[model samples]
Every structure is written in structure tokens, then in C-alpha cells.
Target: MIRTVLSLIPAEYARLTPRFLAAVVAQAICQAIAYVLLVPVLKSLFGDDQAAAWAWVAPMLVAVVGVLVLGYLQSLLGLRIGVGMQADLQTRLGDQLNTLPLGWFEGRSAAALSHVVVDDVREVQGLVAYLLAKVIAGVVVPLGVAVGMLFVDWRIAVTMFVAAPVLFAVNSIAGRLYSWSDRRIHDAAVESDTRVVEFAQAQPVLRAFGAVGARNRALDAALTGQRSAIVRMVFTAVPSLFVFTILVQAAFLVLAYVAVERVTHGPLSAAAAVALVAVGSRFIEPLTQAAQLGTTLRSGAAAVDRIAGLLAEPALPESTTPVNPGAATVGFDTVSFGYETGKPVLEDISFTVPAGTTTAIVGPSGSGKSTLLRLVARYHDVTRGRIEVGGADVREQPTVTLLGQLALVSQQVYLFNRSVIENIRVGRPDATDEEVRRAAAAARVDEIAERLPDGWDTVVGEGGASLSGGERQRISIARALLKDAPVVLLDEATSALDPHSEAVVVRGVHQLSRGKTVLVVAHRLATIAHADQILFLDGGRILERGTHDELLTAGGRYADFWNERSRAAGWRLEPAPVG
Candidate 1:
């Protein structure tokens, strides 16, 4: 565990480790000196050796002061190392997260991410602060005490050697029991955290179903499991701890018997016998502490494993021969993709989205329309064929260059916890305030922000909860407009809004996509009537392709879908029984 943790730290901090180790050793020696001097102090007070008592008092005072100074320095150094290591882990973890593929985030909740970023690192930080100190003291203090006792009487030291194996066996048993309970407890805690986040986010849906105060069975079960694990751990470990305490006491009993025998009838003086008894108590203290250190080190070891596992997750492969091509036309050359093997969501697809033209994709639910657009964006790379952006194979170009050439505006708009202007500015961090306002005006974002109490300066809550659905869509459009990339991808940009908001948002979308290579996953047929070309998709394949009116004239799947949506759009909620 010591070697594992030390390897994670920066090499510059290597000097501090030995410094703290030395200080802890010095502290153990000082404690022994203080305990040994107590014998002379006691003897002089009781007998006629007044000068001897005064002589021992000076050395005892010096030992006491030395221990206090060493302890202070040990803590200061540990704290410095812990704080530096925590920040370094955060930096390393952040860089690793960026390189991971978006598919890696699937099925991982906000709670799990928070656990890695916060809790796991914190456990290692605590190991540096307190557990490392205990471990060093456990090793150094006992050895120091045993070495001194051997010189006085080798028989008394032999008792400690016998007790060592017994102490280790009992501690090993207790550690195994605690470890089993702790694993269950940790799993339960992670499940409970995930449920809490889900329940809070589902508050609006739960209220609609009249289940606001109702129990969530998954969450309740996880909490109960955590409580049971804690109770079991206590019951199993407490008695075992008492057993360990008795084993340590047995060693002390043997030392007491020998010290008495030497003082009464053999080769020991009264003061020397008293000194062994006093220092013997100090020897037993570290043995008891060593038994508990095993569990503490095991916890730090588990946390280290979790952190190391995440760092080892593979990054998306980068191109050795990176390219920068000229045109913004996108081509899908027999591309295929799937989240899992043997179940391809998109297969053998081929098409072109030309520069400065709108190509809309129309399909029913589960037709892979959205997955098609995601491929061009490289959320996950093609499983079989290659994708082209700016006329170069996306795999051949650097990821940054591919990202720089396109802008995505989807229905799910995520904003930071910052002022309204700042969320819109995420599109181009270096854009001037005036340029931001220009994009906002074009995308109709300024209208929403100006209506708020603080106008452009109003703070949007996490995930843009402070803004309405239409407002967030407009904000996302403004970001795309500000970016001014050559290619634009839209996923049902106005699918979730009312007719009034849809019309206004559609106008904003037009402003953003004008004179750019545009690909849209069209949900409402009416929105794509004037598209330059329309591809009707079903079951991962394009069934028909032509202009909107051209597909309608053919009386195929596109025509049937168009007629159904057109009729549904005209339906109204009114009193039918009045006639």
C-alpha cells in the first residue's frame, strides 16, 4: 500500500516522505526516554537520592519537548503532501475524462461520476493525512521498544516475539470480516446515491402521477442494505477487537512476572525494575494500534484501485496522419455502427449532405435517424466504414479539427450555472460581447434574456432549469450561430415547443443554418416541406429519397407518414357531445 500510493505522487514530493518517517521514529524514541526517566524520579522522591531525581528531571523535560516538536512537524508535512496530491488527482482525472468516448458515459449516472471526482480522491488524501502516520508508528514504535528490552533481559523480549504471530492471526481474521461487510456497504452507497439523483430529477413527473410522497423501492432497498451492513460490521468486529486486546495483555503479564523476579532475588535494582515496568506499558500501546491499522490501510487500497481503474480506461484512438481538408460537404460511405456487436443500429448507409444546402432525414421512431446524425458528429466512431467531413475521412483528421468544422443543435440543451450571456458564449469563448449579442439577436435569444429580471446577466440554473424549453432551444441556436461552423446538425430543433414557439424557433434555426451544410432529423413533416432533399428512413435503411412534394407524389411510405402527421396536426380538444 505504501509503494502504491507513493508511485501516484509527484517525484518532487519524495523528500517529504522520508522526513515524516524520520520524525515519527524520533517521536517513538523520545516516548521511551520519558518513560525510562520516570524510574529515577520515583526512586529519588522515595529514597535519599535527591540529586539523582533532579538529574533525571532535566532529561525527561527535554524528551517531552522533543516529542511535541516532532509531532507538529509530522502533521505539517503530511498535510502539505495530502493537499498537493488531491489537486494533482483532480487534474489527471479531468484530462482522462476528456479523452474518453461519449459511449463510455452511457449507463453511468451523475452520482457515479461524482464518486470518482470527489469521494475516491478524498479517501487517498485522508490516507496521507492520518493512516500513514499510524502505520509508521505501528512498525517503528514496537521495534524500538523491543530492541531496548532485549539489552536489559532477553527473556522478556522473547515474549513479544511469541505474541506477534498470535496478534497477526486474530487481526487477519477481523480484517477479512470487515472487508466483506465494507464491500457490500460501498455498493449500497453508490446505488442509493444514483437513486437520489434520479428521484430529484423526476419530481415533476412524480407530481403529475400523484406519487410525490410515495416510496421508491430501489432507493429504500439500497438504504436498508447499507444499514444492515453497518450493524453486521459492528457485531463481528467489536468482539474480535476484545479478543485481540486479551492477546496483547497476555504478553504484558509475562513481562511483569520477569521484571519482579529480577528485582526481588536477582540481577536488577529497584529503579531499573521500575523503569522496565514503566516503559513496558509504552511498548504494549503500539501493538494494539498496529492491529487496527490493517483495516485502515485496506480501505485506502480499495480507493486506490478504483482511481487507477478509471485512469486505465482506453482513450479514443487519434490519427497518426492528421489532415485538414478544404470543402464542408459530408459523405457517409457505406457506414455502419452499433453500441454492441451483432446488433447494428445503423448499417451500410451512404449519403451526402452538400455545403450550403439543407438535407433532412425523416423516419419513424427507432428508424436510426438520430444515430445517423450522431455518426457525422463522431460521438462514437463508425464501427465499419468511414465518415467524411470537409471531404476528408473523419478518422484521418484530428478530432479537434473535425469538431471545429461542425456545430450541433439538439433538443436537449445543457447550460452551465452561469449568467445567461455566459451560456450563449460557450460556442466561442473568444467572441466579443458585441458579437455574442449579434448571434443572440439573429437566433432570437436576446428576446428571452431581456425579458428576465437581470436581462443578459440573469443566472441560469444547472442544466438550464431556470429557462423554459423554448428559451433553452433558442439559447442553443444562438451558440451555434456564434460558432459559425461550416456544417450544422439539428435534431428536431422545434419538436418539443408549442406552435407559436415553433414558428419563432424555426425562424431562428433558419438564421443559424443559412449558407451552411445542414443535416436535420426532421420529426414534424411540415417543417421540412421546402428541404433541398429528403431521405425517408425505416429500419436503418433509406426507403425513399427526393424532394418533399416528389416523395408525396410517389404515394409511398413518405406520403403515408406525411398524410398521417398532417391529420394529427389538425386535431383539437373541444366538446364533441354538444351536437
Candidate 2:
């Protein structure tokens, strides 16, 4: 455990910097000097025959008071420095999280990351401040007292010196045991966090399925693991305390025997022997402090490792090229993509949506229609070929620049717990209140807002659970309308709506897509029927492509899918009327 803790000290020191170390060292030295100087005056006070003893007593009191004042000031300085360091670490961690690839977030548990960033980081601050101060004071003060002991009597000093090796060996073994248990405890904490998040997220489903008892059992299991780990940690620490107490008692016995022998031989004064006993009794204070600090240091080192791992996650390469989206034309040039190796999601997909036109992609489930739309927004890079906007590869353009040219309204709308107007403003932060209201009206969100408590200022619960699905979709559309990007990507924008609501949202979508390049993953036949171009995808390949009328005439995958959907919706399949 000492090895792990010692490894973290250099990192903490480096992070805190030389100035903080200097302050801590200066404080420790001052405290040690105060103790050494007070010993003599304290010894003088013991004498029965006083020759103006108040003179020495007053000076000693003043010096002790001065040391206390300096120590308080140093503590305040260390606290400020620690808070500042923690703030810097949090900022860096937040920035690193944003820069990491989306897939990194997919693989990790959000609750575990949350615990490390919040709870673990806070622990580090306490550990760094308390353990560092204790270690410094423990080493300096103990060494000063040992030197003072030698001045009183070399025999007592020799006993302390001889006992040092035994103390080191005991502490070293205890430290290793503490470290092993501490790591287990930290892991259990992370697991508990993961289980809590999972449980909360699954509560609705669990309740729907009447599986609350099952979930409770799972939670109990996680808590049981955490309790067991903590119990093991206590077992490791309790034995160390026993050993430390025994060692301190043995040291006192040796000092007492040596003092008696010296007094008998007339080599030590009686007052000096009494002072040596007083100092020897307090000698274990530093060693005990150091032992407790070892545990804190070990826990802090584990936290540092977790934070470092988060920061080390891969980030997308920075782009230097500026984007000039001349026409908002989106084109896929032989693009191939796979979420995993040897199992392609989209293979050799190629298509183009010209400026000021709507292009609909129709496919069965898992046919990669949404993936293609994601590529246009550059959510994930292509594995092969290129995705270009306005005649330039997206990979060559800055991500901010690429994103600025497009607005996305996904099937899954994620709303923050904020006022409706503020959520809309996320897409265009500088938009005026009037502008936001206008967008909301245009998206037909006003229909739902009229029933809301405060209209546009009404707070939507997390994920917009306060509103119905169709209402959430309208708010998402309002956000996109507010951004007013030249290119719009809609993934089942109207899928959440009832027929009447769908009509309202579809009209709004039509208005929003005016004079802009729109690429839609079409779930409704009505949405695709109006598209100037339609791409029929099957088995990760573009099986057919043409205008809606041309594809219907071709009577291939598009016709088959249209017929199947038309039958499912109970729509009559009739011949096309003369135009």
C-alpha cells in the first residue's frame, strides 16, 4: 500500500507545484523548531527553586502562540491551493470528456464515470491536503524530537534509533494489506454507482413488467458486495492499530530501563530523565499519523489512475481547414461503414441530394438508413470512401464548421430539464425571445404550449417526460427550425405523432425544408411520396434509386416495401391517377 501511495505523491506534488510544496515544508520546519525550543523552557519549569522563572515562561508562551498563528495561516494557504487545483482538474476532465469519441461513451458506464469525476475527485482533494500535511509534520517533528532526546541522553536516543527498523517493517506490511483492501473498496463503489444508474434508467420498464422485486434483489446484491469490501478494509486496518500500540509500549519500556540505569550511574540528571520520559511518550505521535496517512494516500492514488484513464480516451483529430458550404449539397461517394469488424452496417453506399431538394431514404429496419444520415452529420466517420458537403470531404473540414451547416432532428429527442424557450435556444443560443416563440409557433409546438402552465417559459422535465411523445417531437422540430441550417437531416421526424399531429408536424417540416437540402430517413410512405429523389436500401446496399414515380414504375424493392407498408396501414392500393 505504501508503494502505491508513494507513487501518487510525486504526481500530486507536480500538480500542486513548487510553491505549495515550499509553503508546506516551511510550515513543518517552523512547527518542529517550535517544539524543540519549548522543550527547554518546559524542562526549566519543572525546577522547584525558581530564579525569576516567569521570564522564561513568558517567552516560551509567546513563541508557542506565534507557531500556532503561523500553522493556521499555512493551513489556510494549503486549502486555497487544493481548491484551485481541484477546479483546474475538473475543467480539464470536462473538456476531455467532450473531446472523446462518441463510441467511448457508448462502451462505458455513465454512473461509474460520474462517481470518479465527482465523488472520487473530491476524495482526492481531502487526501492530498490532509495526508500531505500529516506526512510532512510527522517526519520533521519526529526527527527534531529524536535530536532533542540525544541532547538529553544518548542512551534513550539509541533506543529510539534501534526501534525505528521494527516500526518500518510493521508499517510496510500493514500498508500493503491496506492498499489491497482499498482497491477492492474503490471497485465496489464504482459497481454500486453503475447499478444505481442502471436501476433508475430501467425503473419504468421494470414497473411495467412487474419486476420490481427482481430489481430490488439486484440492488441488494450490489450493496452486499460494497459492504463486504468495506468489512475487509476494516479488518486490515484494525490489526495495524494493535501492532502500532504494542510497538509504542515496547519503546516506552526500553526508554524507562535505560533512564533508570543512567540515573544510577550518575551520568544523567534527574530533571533530564523526567524530560526524556515526557518526550519519549509523545514520540509515537508522528509514526501513528504517518500510518493513517498511508491509507488516505493509497485511496487517492486509485482515484488519480481512474481520472487519467478517462483523459487518455482517444479524441477526434483536430481539423484546420475552413468550410465553405456553397450549396448544402450532400453526397456519399462509395462510403462503407461498420460498427464492428466484419459486420458492415452500410456497404459501398453512394448517393447525392442536390441543393434545394428533398431526398428520402427508405429501407426495412437495420437497413442503415439512419446510419447514412448520421454520416452526413459526421457523428461517425466512414470506414471507406468519403462523405462530402459542397464538394469538400467532411473529414477535411472542422467539425464545428461541418455541424454549423446542418440541423438534425432525431427520432429520439433528448430534452434538458429547462424552460421550453431555453431548450430551443440550445440550437441558436443568441436567438431572441421573439425568434424562439416564432419557431415554436411554426413547428406547431404552440398547440401543446397552450395547455402548458407558462407556455414558452414552462419547464420541461428531463427527457421531456412532462410532455407527450408528439409534443417532444415538435419541440425538437422547433429547435431545428430556430437553428435554420441550410441542410436538414430528419430521422423519423413525424414518427412519434398521431395522424392529425403528424399532418401538423409534416407541414412544419415542409416549411422548414424549403429551399434547403433535406435528407430524411422515411418511415411513412406519405413522407417519401413527395421526395424529389428516393433511395431504396436493402441489406446495407442501395438496391434501387430514382424519383418516387420512377421507382413505383420500376416495381422493385421500393414497390414491394410501399405495398407491404400500405397493406399494414390498411390503405387501398390503387393505380396512379393521370397527372
Taking all chains together, each candidate's TM-score versus the true structure is 0.84, 0.79
Scored by Cα lDDT, where does model 2 land?
0.77
Per-residue CA lDDT of candidate 1, range 9-63, in tens?
Answer: 7566667888977887788777766765666676676566778789879998999
lDDT of 1 at 404: 94
Q: Which ten contiguous residues of candidate 2 have the minimum total lDDT?
A: 1-10
lDDT of 2 by residue, 1-579 (tens): 223323334344455445655665666665555555444555566666455456656665665675576567657756765666577667778888877655457556767778777877787667656566676677666666667667666767778778766776787787678778877887788788777766776777778877576557777777899999999898887698578768867877787777767777876666656766666666666777676666776667667767667767778775897767677899998999998889999999888899989999998888989889888877678899999987788888887888888889888898999988888889899999899889999999888888998987899987776887778888888999999999999897675578888887787888788888999999888889989999999889999999888988999989998888888888557999999
Instruction: For candidate 2, list the clashing residue pairs, or say none.
Output: 1-176
lDDT of each prediction vs. the true structure?
A: 0.81, 0.77
Error of 1 at 578 (Å): 5.0
Q: Which candidate is the best by TM-score?
A: 1
Clashes of each: 0, 1
